[model samples]
Target: MERKVPTGIYGLDELIGGGFRNNSVNMIFGGTGVGKTTFSMQFINYGLNRGEKGIYISMEMTEEQIIRESKQIGWGEIEKHIEKGRLRIIHTHGEDIVILSRFLQDIEEEIGEEEVRLAIDPLTPIIYNVQQKRHRKTISEFFNGLRRFGTSVVTLEEMEGVEMMPLYLADSVIKLQSLGYGERYDRTLRIVKYRGGKHGEGLYPFSIERGLGIVVDVTEEQINRVTPKMKYREYFEDAKRKIRQVEGELREALLNKIEALETSWTRDESPERVLQMFFRTELGREI
Candidate 1:
């Protein structure tokens, strides 16, 4: 049997075939006012449903604010878990990022002792702090440190223009796109990439309401299919091997042309001119 993890999403599990694998850094990125926080709540809710303890790390929202917003979405049951000592909410303090980095370090020490599933809401504060404070070195080290702890982490990131700052760092990058049509808006989620793991492609719609909590409408596949008309890994590997072969041939052809130019000499041209000619001819363009 294939082991699976729960994503705490509505209709998404069927799309990915299962949840995200254990100990992977899963990132959710989008513009402001998207469902990033709600999605975070859903994951914590999933852990709660499974009777696992969870921790909510907030850099912007107060713990009370989180509870209230959750209640508005009918996830007020979150408080019950807190009451049972199954959930912990940590608010971000001064110099937001330094405080939070210290906070994450502290939590790392506590995870094993507490066995808590953690969710860090809105990664903007962390990125902003690093940029404003010139802590690029520390930020990367911090991310790698957290991954070393081997816990399920979902961090929310905000993207503007075409930047890969945090996206390049995460093991999995999930993009939540928000679209407005007429007077209504919709949110969609897609895995931009999943390192060392498999995921579904394209966008999947999501919705949230007080009574329904959160829901996703996506495609489904036969999870039990034992036979295949095609096997992706084997076929994809073959394609890659062929592409490598073509690239090698092109590279060797270029090298041979360069060597051929070195053997030819023109006595009429100056030394500099001769070298330039060799470069242009061998490169097949202006060098």
Candidate 2:
């Protein structure tokens, strides 16, 4: 089995096929105020709770600022973790970054730690200020340096109209988007890439709460209310009939997928979600 690590964000791991691959580097990118920093902090806290040491290297925020914000979100134990040396927060000034590759090499040489969870918040500052000719090479080298500490999550600020180099180098990519302003705004997350898992695609709604942190918006109550096994049998037969009604080429494809779905049911996978995906993708309708 591929070793995986939980992201600690509610309802997200299941969508990404059971968290991230261990020892892999993942990148989270978003516009300003889109919760990249909060997500990164939550990831570190989750690992800390799991008895794993964590490191957070911030370019835009001070160690105190990070602790203060973490406290605001009810992560009171953050200070204790720091005091006990379970977590280390590093502040890298966002000064000249012309030689960011060399800078990262120096930082990695300084730490000399292995297999720790690392989060670099706002990697954009350094990469953004680097000279254009060496952009991709520099970004690749920075990621190579991060691997010295094991599985890493790097957060980057999304420039208004510029494509970032780190987005392509990371093992996986998660994008957060909050559109509009104020009460009418909508927040969504997309797993743009997951290197080795059958992850869910497209946008998923999510919200940030005081105690819960990031929670994916799931319509379980309205759409996935559990039914007894006898009722499931009835639905299963009905699904078979519906699949039979599909036209030639699509019918063959649905049959193959439905067989997989049948096996999934035995594993206690969400029948509602499977059926919904069937309807949405195969039939272009909803359950």
Query: Candidate 1 — what's its lDDT?
Result: 0.64
lDDT of 2 by residue, 216-285 (tens): 8745442122212233565566677788987778787877766545533433344776677778886789
Instruction: Compare the candidates by TM-score and give the number of the best one.
Output: 2
How would you encode candidate 1's per-residue C-alpha lDDT over 223-250 as one tens digit per residue? 2221122323343333334334444466
Q: Cα RMSD to native, each candidate?
A: 13.2, 8.3
Worst 10 residues of 2 by lDDT: 222-231
Model 2 regions more than 4 Å off: 96-98, 109-111, 161-163, 181-185, 219-287
Return the TM-score for candidate 2, rounded to 2 decimals: 0.72
What are the per-model numbers of colliding residue pairs?
A: 0, 0
Q: How high is the lDDT of residue 277 in model 2?
A: 76
